[model samples]
Target: MTDFTEYAKALRARIDIALNQVIPETPNSQLAEAMRYSLASGGKRIRPLLLFAGYRATAGQQEHPALEIAACALEAIHAYSLIHDDLPAMDDDALRRGRPTCHLAFDEALAILAGDALQTLAFELLADTPGLTDSTRVQLIRSLSRAAGMRGMVVGQAIDLAAVDTELNITRLEHMHRCKTGALIDASVTMGALIGGASDQQLNILARYSRSLGLAFQVHDDILDVTADTATLGKQQGADLARNKPTYVSLLGLSSAQARAYELYQEALTALAELDGDTELLQRIAHYVIERRH
Candidate 1:
């Protein structure tokens, strides 16, 4: 049995290094600093870890350029989304990862530009990866674009903004999350599988696993919003309630939301079990998703 804590630590370290290396050197010092500020702001790095775990699940061991590029690219996308999500027009958050958000650390204009640069940089990294075939690169770019674009995260955000103080059922909530959070999460694993040469059946199974884990991740996030304090969560406690946002805890209540997260965790584990290769890391990740306080 691998020590998942140690594994995650090492994985995060590697990802941090890759992200630093890939961040472009801009002539404008403020732009560079703002970009680094948000990208380096510490978090769980779950998206990149999922990419690595998906690769490992497919028995991919040898070094390849696509792996790090894909991991860092997905992290970049995640970071950019957070930056934009914290803007006044969006979630209007002040804190992230226990620190001031990019907009607060810098100005609103710099934060917006930083997010824009990071989003474009993600695709640039994928397009410029050295070892992948053109077809693979195209697939990776197309997949990520869709996940980050209007069809996925953007649409989810639009729906979320529209849903504020409005009635929402579990199904609609799930659909929103599936686009907002789940799309990138699904892309992380699916891109890893593509890089690792996964068969159609393997891709399907991993998709199921990632989907379950993604929703579980959001469910636990909602749970933590009500149960955990700001220091523990690294963000405002009860922000959802304050904003009157729809969340699992809001719709299903704390107990049912917690139970639903557990159920999704089981579904993720079952999906991982269908994979032929080692899935211990992914299973651990599923548990981490529901169990993490922040």
Candidate 2:
């Protein structure tokens, strides 16, 4: 029997290597440099790995021939979001993975272009991955686009920015996060299920699991904002406080936020159970999402 952690480690390594291979360095290409700076920062590749693991737990064989491409495409989209998030007009984050963010590492203009290029590259990669049926390919493409587009992460971000310095009730905050953070995370799991050819029923169950997990992920992240070290987080600690942004902690207090995270995790696991498969990986990933120090 394979150790699940070891399996995850091997899988993440492969995904990272595949990501580097997808867009190699090219001189006179500062866009490449900016993209590299963000994508190579070495954060946990949870999103990509979740796609693989979700596929493994639900549908066809683990590491399906298309798994690598699916994982890489998800990571590419994630990296692009990070680049734009750290922009001066956006999050204004200076550090990521303990180093300068893309706009800080490269010029802002180049960083913007890098983000644009990466977003396009993500779709291109998905469209070109070999061995997937035409239906599955089209499904993944549309699924990813909707999750990242105006109705999803983009809207969530817009809500977040606008909500700053303004009072937001828990209902409103959750709605914002459901789009902003939850959408991408859900998309990650959904794409995995889709690529693995999960039935519509299985996909629906995974969607519930992903949504709960995504909310839990963000609640924990907000807690980490206060509890984690800046060096370990590779970003400023207390940033939410600094910006006066609405957060679980700010709205509910630390203990309450912690409680909410656990509650969401429970909901996630229950949803996972509803799907009725080998949940060892999903359970571990859920635990890791909440327990991660950084």
Candidate 3:
């Protein structure tokens, strides 16, 4: 079995290759340039890797070509969201992953176009994944649409925008993170499980695991935004405070947030225990996610 670190490295490489292949720079194609610019901006590819890991935990990543493509689609959708989230009308950040945000790197109009194109391209890629049967392709598209659309990531983003001026307590904060972040993270695992042909029962358990991990991931992120340095995080720390956005830290305080993250992590691992998982790898990943500086 591959060590978690090695697997993560390999997954990152694969994500980069897939992004490069799908996002092209063609002559006279403004749309293409936008796609390339946004995609090439580069982040950790965590969403795609999560999808791949879930895929592997059920059936290996190569079991279905559609799974790989669909996982990449999730990352594209994720990336597009980040691009728009950083716009002047959105988070208005100048830096992302330690580089200029898409709007900062390119003109605002082009950045908008880039984000739009990527959103559509995510679905297009899912629909046309090379090796999936027609039914599976359709299922993948439907799942992603549900997760990335209004009921999911979009709704969360809207709530986040609204909550900027308004202070949210723990309940509202959890709701926002559930929609904003957890939806896609849940989808990442769900899509992978379905594509890997997991039993319905197995999928159910995995969904529960993903749901917990997703929130934990966000809590860890919220903490890191305050504690980690800019270099490690690849973005400015305290941007949440700067924007006056309500966060776990702001709502529950750092110690409480940290405790909550740990609680969620334990719940996630406990859910995994019911399944026949390769425990060490998942455990290592669990440790890595919470402990990561970035």
Q: Point to the candidate with the largest lDDT.
A: 1
Model 1, 74-125: lDDT tens per residue? 9889999999999998999999989999999999999999999999999999
State, as a TM-score between 0 and 1, how close model 2 is to the true structure.
0.96
TM-score of 3: 0.94
Q: Rank the candidates by lDDT, best first.
A: 1, 2, 3
> For residues 1-294, what per-residue lDDT tens digits would candidate 2 score against the true structure?
277678778877887788888885566577787777777667788998688767877774546788788788888888999899889999899988889888878889999988888898889988998988988899989988998899898999999999989999999999999998888888888888887778889988888888999999999999999999898898999988899999999999999999999999999888888776666778889988999898
TM-score of each: 0.98, 0.96, 0.94
Query: Which of candidates 1 and 2 reaches a greater lDDT?
Result: 1
Q: How many residue pairs clash in each candidate?
A: 0, 0, 1
lDDT, model 2, position 24: 54
C-alpha displacement of 93 in model 1, angstroms? 0.7
Q: After superposition, which runs of candidate 1 have C-alpha atoms over 4 Å from their true positions?
A: none
- The TM-score obtained by model 1 is 0.98
